[model samples]
Target: MSERYEYQPHRLLRQRVRDIPSGAEGVLMAVITEDVSPNGIPHWVDLAYIRNKSGREFTTAVGNIEPA
Candidate 1:
């Protein structure tokens, strides 16, 4: 089984694309359990717990860039 991630107490972060093999663009939400890089900035994001304008919850890292 895969590990489960919690969404409660929604946390926000200002992370840079460290790896995007795909050409898609979009806002990505990842588990901030550990720091990835020095450039990976952390911040509180206003998570509404709803689909984005494009009807997506944290798109793939390679997906289109979604607004925050």
Candidate 2:
């Protein structure tokens, strides 16, 4: 079984990408707008649209998010 993470809507979460390039040293502070899960796994939350501090929103896989 794969590990799962639960994120709530309207919550602020610090996110960072795995295996970031050496020159890049930063993480994104975003707010969870919604939860997206294609599979019916109770503890699995797959995707979400997060709005960054700059007000830019993007979609990313849950596995790529590192909790801050």
Candidate 3:
């Protein structure tokens, strides 16, 4: 089952980087902008408007995010 997340605008979140090889664990911090779930399951989020600690922003799947 997919986990449910309650996200609010501007809320800081920690996202895991699973796409990277080498099994190098990495976490990215970002602020929530809006829910981008296409099936209305809150499974995706838009972070393009928020930047990370390095001032980088992106949109990713909700499975990558966790409470910061």
Candidate 3 global CA lDDT score: 0.44
What lDDT is reached at residue 53 by model 1?
40
Query: What tens digits encode model 3's per-residue C-alpha lDDT throughout 1-68?
Result: 24443345433335544322232333554444464567876654444222345655555543444433
The lDDT, on a scale of 0 to 1, for candidate 1 is 0.35
Higher-ranked by TM-score: 1 or 2: 2
Tens digit of per-residue lDDT, candidate 2, span 1-68: 34344445433245543312222222444434343355764544445444555666566654454443
lDDT of each: 0.35, 0.44, 0.44
TM value for model 3: 0.27
True-vs-predicted CA distance for residue 51, candidate 3, Å:
2.0
Weakest 10 consecutive residues of candidate 2 by summed lDDT = 17-26
Cα lDDT for residue 19, candidate 3: 21
Residue 2's lDDT within candidate 3 is: 44
